[model samples]
Target: MVTTQERVGAEPDFALNPSGQFGVYVHVPFCASRCGYCDFNTYTPGELGGATPAGWLEALRSELALASQRLPGPTVDTVFVGGGTPSMLGGDGLAEVLDAVRSEFTLAPDAEVTTEANPESTSPGFFTRLRTAGYTRVSLGMQSVAPTVLRLLDRVHSPGRALDAAREAQDAGFEHVNLDLIYGSPGESDDDLHRSVDAAIGAGVDHLSAYALVVEDGTALARRVRRGEVAAPDEDVLARRYELLDTWLADAGFTWYEVSNWSKPGGECRHNLGYWNGGQWWGAGPGAHGFVGATRWWNVKHPNTYAALAEKRELPIADFEVLAPRDRHVEDVLLQIRLRSGLPTSLLDADEQARAESAVAAGLLVHDGHNLVLTDRGRLLADGVVRDLLAD
Candidate 1:
């Protein structure tokens, strides 16, 4: 169990908004093996010692029970199961997870439930079970279709596995399937990306998310880059790849809703939109972060430690921070400006408003009614535009 000292300052210092969206994020820390480039909080089988999915589920149920008490009962609008590799839990394990959620809180009539799966670890039966259990969407990590790129990234899935899995999810009655791609990896050619995107689109999935690969610190990829065994991602090449993917998705009738995500009409991920739009959510599980009322809290990261705390009927909370007004505004501008719908001008101060006008003149932003939307050129430099707008 966590020490009293760890929970001393964990109490939320803020309050909830009492209005807007509410969701839950359940983190699964178990993976068959860790990825070379992932910095997310997850544990591989060897690293987990004697920890198993059964034990983890018991702890999860406890955390959710305790969380319901504090958050009081609100109808949950979304539930996202993310992890080391959720599919590693197999079909029964995933269904048990949803049942655990239902045991504690009431899910909305049309709650958007989702799970992220590894392509190699899934099957038609697995998707079928999840669909039967009320899961509305599946996100597969397709990273890329090139064998060389897969090896460099330490991804184990066959080039075609993600597509097959996506098709399986559709056949299992899931209308929304999302394929995640990591572009600009070392050794990835333009043709390699074309084949990947073509296959993903042809698989009849509705959603696509592509992100530029970053060599994060403390990861194996970072170490390789440090040792010069792996070349750092080139900014210019990444920009080119992103433009190509964007063009291809647009041609296929997919529209960009957020910078890294595209989907056919009405396929945007509601759970993630809850995040980008500042909706409240309970982050249950080891290393999960949640926001509700006014405070944002994250649980202890290690699975063993988290389980210990939950077994004791403790919150497993590591710490929390209350968002001040400025914190909210800065986050509002930072997140809302990245969306296709645009950010309202009223959220900005006079000086920031002046910067927005300057940005519009510079072709980095355009005024859409009272909202400030990024221009096509502006998206390439999205972060820089935010900095210019928020610069003191």
Candidate 2:
């Protein structure tokens, strides 16, 4: 079995190794407005109106150049441009950033380049331009189709607009289009969740990411929930909602590849799959995180600071930690269990294997020869299951 100790011991500096499969993540920290539940490092013009995207783009280009020099010789298999709202950066800005990537790295001919965008920000012409710029995939944030739920989430776009955006993307010749939906919000009913799912399927999305709303600490949602201004759904309700999503999407011919992701045949997000499989990826821009094998690093959170560091021709890495062998193994097992691929028996030690057997007997996991995967009930309590399996 491939224990965490063995993997970590063999590759102490996996991040520095040049011959590993590498992915790229570019963060665009600008958003027209922040969602109440969002805590990602995103800035709005109101927050940083004085700063121009031109300077930030140059800084990002410089950072990519420096990263290319430092980490030489890995073919980039996927590129994900995630953001406060990547679409906010008009076509020209995206083109410039993509151009820099091509010049600095070896991108696979069929590399899946995806960008996260809000439906309200997309322009039909702009999406076509993005396609010409080499972006093959687009993930639109269509949190909910219900107007009340949209207001609760502070989303600016309506259901019709979101649908229009998806249609526009398809018309623009995007090979793959994904829709992100959030469920279990305060006052969100089963009907509301079903409506969103129906909308996603009706839109003919290649991929769907349906996440349950979690009251993250420090977010407005959390504050509201704590103050009783908003009520959090019970675990039972959330579980029922998730099960409904699975059954409905599966019936619609979408496969549940990951716990929260469903896709049509051959439509899974390759970049995300790389992450779950413990592959290497380089993250650029403010507050972006990267995992190069066992070593994980993140850039500075402040946009200006990150830009200044890159402007000085330095890697903007603010903090980093090299994972211990056990940590890496635990991560692998945890991530693998969340997918249909399942965790290999080799990844567990004797103790972990025993625990897995117990979990399978308890109906939390299914053991298929060399692989162990979470069952539906197990997925609902995934965090608890991971903790139990990883217990020393």
Candidate 3:
């Protein structure tokens, strides 16, 4: 069990708009195999020991019931099931999870429900079942098409399989589909990146998410780089890749709704947009993080411990932080600047207003009347720009 000091004066200084968006993010911690570059809190069957999917479902149901009572509000606007591999749960299993949510809280009439699936784990039959089970969207992990890059990343799906899966998901009647990509893999070349992008567009997916490969510590990729078995990603190369991706996607009629994310008009991921817009959400499953009002909390990392707490009808909170007003404003600035909508200048103090002017003068930002939006160059240095805006 975890312990924490009681917090005083922790009442929410700000309130959520009753009509604002809320979402449910369910994390599935099981994977068939752990990838070398993955650091997410996931476990393979062998590592899971005696943990079972049934146990996870039970725990999830418990949490949903509890949250429904604790967070009384309008029906959820969106629901996203993400994971090590949510498709591993199969159709019936996935149905059960969604059913639990439906029973606990009302879902909006036009709610967008999504699940992340690995290509190899999905089939026409599986997608059909999912469609019948009420999943309206699917996001597939198609990291790369290069054989060497796939092998290095330890992805099990063949390049052909991902494309086929995308087509299959469309055929299954999913209204919205997303294809995710990774650039800057150690051995990935410019040609390889172009091929991947070409294949993704050819799949006719409405939404695309391309991310730079980050060799996080404690992952096998980090160790390999440390030992010189593979070279680390170069920042210069990553920037160039981002530029190429942006140009190509825009030329293809996709707009950059957020840095690293593009979509055809009216095809943005509403679930994710809720997050960037400061909407409240409930996160279920081991290691999931949730935000409600001014309080943000995370669940225990171990499945066993989380399950035990659920069995006892206790919240599995491992730790929490109550955000002060200033902390919330800083986060708002950080998130809004990454969006196409830009951030309002009124949120900044007099000192920050000066930095905003300098940023615009430097061409890193452009004024949208009273809002500050990042230019293409500004997005490449977004982190630095945010730091400058928040600088003392």
Candidate 4:
């Protein structure tokens, strides 16, 4: 496990091409409430005590100002505001966040700016302002459309809210809309997932991200499963659900671009593509992570500490490591293989290339003369395939 240490002072590497495609990821750690299945670094107003939204925004601005000076570059090609509930900051607050980013970096001619918003937290005014503020995309956390599934996941939105939010965003002039779905919740049925998919398609979203629910340790859901309050979905059942989701999404005119992401042609989330394709980015806010070249680092997890660092005009970087060549290669395989363009064979060595060939023979991949693309089955067993490809 990569562990964090105290921030070791160093200048951000400005050796990057000034005109390169750079991304900015700003984290908003505030949420209305904690969901049972969530373990992300997020806090509610009650839990946050005196750490008001205004203070957090102030600290974020300080970090952005500092980062802009440290890493001089052309306008950011993409920016993603995620976590807690970004919409809870309200449209004006979100606009302010973007404005701070603008003060430091210029936005590219077609910069893909995205924000992840919860369904219940948005309105017409909110969407209208977001578009006016220059946001190009909105990814709403729809989770599931079934009330039972929503309750099981501890999601607060009503069954129709996500669809309603999607329509509202479109009405507000956002053609680039994405709905995030979570399948395999303990009580989620095939029919429930069907409704969810149908509703997402009906919403006319251009992008969809359907993920399998994994009960991570320490989450409230994990505890429920541990105490037998809820049964975990059987592996075979989850597999079938995944197949159903893929079929439904494909029939709805969406193409699988990643393991859990689908999109219409030209509707892919460019900000995410930046991350998967190894582009440089600076992560702002508490518990955010950033990367430049082979060096990756994370900020302090606590909002108070993060605020203190920023107020002191510090980078707020907690720890960083220059990835070893092997580490970088393993990560490339891990991320690139899951992408639709597939992993380039040129990234592998003679031994790994042989392994790739062996994987092809095993029906886990198809070498299309240039790139090694995952077959349908390979995507389902991607973890094992990654391990095999990385094997010594």
Candidate 5:
């Protein structure tokens, strides 16, 4: 449990939290256009129709202030602004949010601030403004560099524009840039995937997050697939693609830091790392989720409702639950197993450890000192392996 003293700093003057850590995630739910495969909570401004008229910024600030009041502690170590397309916020709006964050929390001097951007929404001047506004890292969504694949995914920007955005991000003096790509799209060939990878490497970013497409039930992609409009890639094909991606990225001097993330030396995303490591963070904005100690909560999904509730000086929490110790333990095991660090022996019982040992002996895991990590083949069946190891 977080003590009251820990929640609020003791001294009248600025005092850092003794815990020395906390992360902040700001969600920007505005998107110019939603992708076919995306089911994230988002809305186009055109749909707003002046109901709130850019009031989200103020509402978000108010919400942040509320969060500060509830969990007033030291400066945050990392801040990540992710979204439908955070670049849609233009430079000025982005600056306003960042300013609010600075006032609400003690931000570390070298805190890593990352913002997600879509190639179509990004400009060189905009990137420069973001840098001046204190964003140290930029993640660009360049899902695919092939025209056919882009069309299949309904990406707003052309392949050329995506590459240009990457170059512009570098030119804007961002020390760390991440390019996001998606594999296993319908009708995507191995050649197409390779070209996308080659293009990303050519664009010269510090990190890459390549994800396989999953068809969520209510998504447009899933509906289309059901209607025979697009064909989903088979498991065998996806496995081959994953293998190629792992091999190629390793050859390109990138480390597989997580299942879907690869980064150059010293370039891992600290905010995401905090999640995997079970660190505490505050999540603000519509549909944003936060984990503080054992309690997990999420904000309301509707923008107008969220703003309205915040205006009344109340948290827009739609639902929340305090996890039991056993639940927390299970989650810790599950999250850790997905990372390269693997799980500590102390996290599992003797019976579970015996099962893990058998898997290790079968070459699915490698024992590294006190931790057990997945081998390449194990990564392919990570879900099943984790379930087996965590089973009671």
Candidate 6:
């Protein structure tokens, strides 16, 4: 058994879990091109200087080996390969990533292995290769079907590519395929949003995740908004879009498992659920964040730095924070309350329970015996509801 100090030689004390449920998150921070709204730590070929996938794979293997030793006993239940366009690695490259993971950590009998793919970069052959390589799920970014919206977001795929990719994944034996949609882009209209969702539903994917376009600072969208070249998504418009999405998805037999995600039965993304439902997981690769026990840590944002640290046989942890009791309670109320299972009211203090009562009376929440669940109206204000529950 490797001691905690053995996890990251130069870093502060880490690796807080020895047993229990855990997952693995692998980040591939390489994209074909930068998306306007993306602020994630990704580098295109031009930005990479001289970094190569071969070099990155070695670093990833090193990290996973350390993680396996650091958190022994319990096997990983899920593996999520997220990206800077993971599909950019092609089928063989992604297969190498999973091979590295398997060689290091022991996985559960039915581990759900998933990878996020870009529509333009994926194909029937790509999906089939992934299935053959043991990937059980595929998530493709299908932000919008509108050409103008795609251009505005700097997406490279054509309007029909996402729909094509989704169908190919299903045909390639992916039962848990997910398509992501982004609503409320400045140039997008209601018809565009409707058409996009309808097309996604028609594509036979089992899961859909829709999010309002957010203009984060340092992103191209933020710069455009600051220059008055584009308008920020209106709050009222976003709410209306959310309502429309819920109604449409519900009518199509999909259920909202979380505020931003909907899916057919048993089609939910388990790796994401791990993040929301207080499960421990190791996050490898550049800019990935991980949580195990009460402690959370993130890797260095630059891929080069991450790889260099791995070269020294060290975990590329940039910083870590051990959550306090109050912090844990606040996070629990904030996250679990948004889920379908709801938060146990027993976890709330007297003041929070009283606040929950007020929310229930206001129809923002409902009491399912011991749990406090968000009503449809409440999900529209999920953040507010969580705040009210935690308010002093």
Most accurate candidate by TM-score: 1
Q: Taking the tens digit of each residue's C-alpha lDDT, what string does model 6 give over 25-118?
A: 9999999899999999899999987888889999999998888777645688999999898998999999999999989888888999999999
TM-score of each: 0.97, 0.94, 0.96, 0.97, 0.94, 0.96
True-structure RMSD, every candidate = 1.9, 4.5, 2.4, 1.6, 4.8, 2.9
The sequence of per-residue lDDT tens digits that candidate 5 reaches over residues 1-392 is 33323432221111223463589999998888878889998887676545342788889989888778777565799999998788888877787778989989989999999999888888999999999999899999998878888888889798888789889989999878999999998789898989888888888888999999888788888899999988976888888899998888899898887888999988899989989888888889889998886677777787888888778877777766667888888888888887888889888888899999988988888898999898999888888888888787
The residue ranges of model 3 lying beyond 4 angstroms of the native Cα positions read 1-19
Please tell me which model should have the higher lDDT, number 2 or number 6.
6
Cα lDDT tens digits, model 1, 5-64, are 667645664255678889889999988777899999989878887778888899999999
Would you list the C-alpha lDDT of every candidate in the order shown?
0.91, 0.85, 0.89, 0.89, 0.84, 0.89
Backbone clashes under 3 angstroms, per model: 3, 1, 0, 1, 1, 0
Best by lDDT: 1
TM-score of 2: 0.94
Candidate 2 Cα errors over 4 Å, as ranges: 1-20
Better of 1 and 6 by TM-score: 1
For candidate 3, the TM-score is: 0.96
Off by over 4 Å in 5: 1-20, 49-53
lDDT of 3 by residue, 1-392 (tens): 12343422122222445666899999999999988899998989888878999999999999898787676555899999998899999888888888988989899899999999999988999999989988999999999999999999999999878889999999989868999999999989999999999999999999999999999999989999999999999999999999998988998889998987999988899999988888888889999988878878888878898899899888777777778899999999999899998989999999999999999999999999889999999999999999999998
Model 1 poorest ten-residue lDDT run: 1-10
Global local distance difference test of model 4: 0.89
